[model samples]
Target: MSISSSGFSWPLRVYYEDTDVSGVVYHANYLKFFERARTEWLRSLGYSQESLRHEVEVAFTVSRVEVAFRSPARLDDQLIATVAVTELKRASLVMTQQLRLGDIDGRLLAEAEVKVVSVDAASFKPCALPDGFRNRVQTVENAASRNPSSSAA
Candidate 1:
């Protein structure tokens, strides 16, 4: 399987618990996969959700999501969830994610545009992203540029 050059990719396997009775991955499970990828992306940059909340007193919450299911994934399928930062603002970020069949030449299965907002961990109110956090993201973006791939249709 080819790696996504435009973003971080997290590999996953469709397990029985992730599928419906018909053996197809349940639609809601795609959200979980996407979440995991995003979390891993943060970890790759030396951050964790907990650390962001505790150390920086900031947390990220999903503000919006727009998803399109182009195909279904069945049980035992190898999937790759790709996460890319499309836009970054003071208090929010727009990310594009894709779920693809990893072993099948990255055939697209589902895609989503997600907006995540930075907030005060205790108050849960909108807050500016930390400067270091933004810098790290910029670093990742720069690295991804070397092997850029379109996240758009």
Candidate 2:
């Protein structure tokens, strides 16, 4: 995994389980890749879902997802999944995520806009995200704005 001013990136290999009989990745599996990238993005800022649930009683849930499949990835292919916060609100944040082949700047296989909400872990009611978490993401965005070269798709 790598962190940059643009966003958080996680490296992954396309396993047999992620692909179809034809060896191309399943459409639904793109969502899983995006989800993992977001989880790691949170971890990069020192927040884990487990810790958040235990300490703050909050967990993130995907409220909406819009995905565009540009190309196909085959089994055993190396990929990079990226997560960048595009918008933030009191209880929800929109992340722009992408799946690329081989490296961060490689061929774009898929891209998605995912809206995630902070919710009460047990009750599953919407809740505001912690100030620290919001601030950390904002800091990253600020840096990205200053250095546009590391832009994420």
Candidate 3:
């Protein structure tokens, strides 16, 4: 997770179905938001679950997750999911994800440290990240690398 790219920033609007009777977004829904951000981030990286299988011969699966709830999101509240790669390994990547509430961005609604493991598509077993992909992600950490600005999550 050493590489940090403004990876993706996706806006999410709270809806009625995402909340409970109290009109506050449910905690579990934060995971859904994180998942969407990660999926899109991967897509932006020119990788997709299906394409990764057919082309790269690999797919990613959740290996670990640790989340902390900080606040509640209310219905109609516009939120932002910011994702960044914080660590990387031969066969896994660690991501730091945050769900910020509204424009104020005062308090985090939720935060997660997620670990994704690369696996061989055919065996569905752990595998090292392909050289091409690994090198591309590593370039972000280079001293002369051009950092991409905040992205649409």
Per-residue C-alpha lDDT of model 2 across residues 1-153, encoded as one tens digit per residue: 122346678888999999998889999999999888888888877889999999989999999999999999999999999887778889988888889997555999999988999999999999998888888888877787678665443
- Model 3 scores a C-alpha lDDT of 0.81
- The positional error of residue 34 in candidate 1, measured at the CA in angstroms, is 0.2
Query: Which segments of candidate 3 are over 4 A away from where they belong?
Result: 4-7, 140-153
Q: Candidate 2 regions off by >4 Å? A: 1-5, 103-105, 148-153
Pairs of residues clashing in candidate 2: none
Per-residue error at 31 for model 1, in Å? 0.3
Tens digits of per-residue lDDT for model 3 on 85-106?
8888999999889888758744
Cα RMSD for candidates in order? 4.8, 4.1, 2.5
RMSD of 1: 4.8
- In model 2, how large is the Cα lDDT of residue 102? 78
State, as a TM-score between 0 and 1, how close model 2 is to the true structure.
Answer: 0.90
Query: What's the C-alpha lDDT at position 19 in model 2?
Result: 95
The clash numbers for all candidates, in the given order, read 0, 0, 9
Report lDDT per candidate. 0.87, 0.85, 0.81
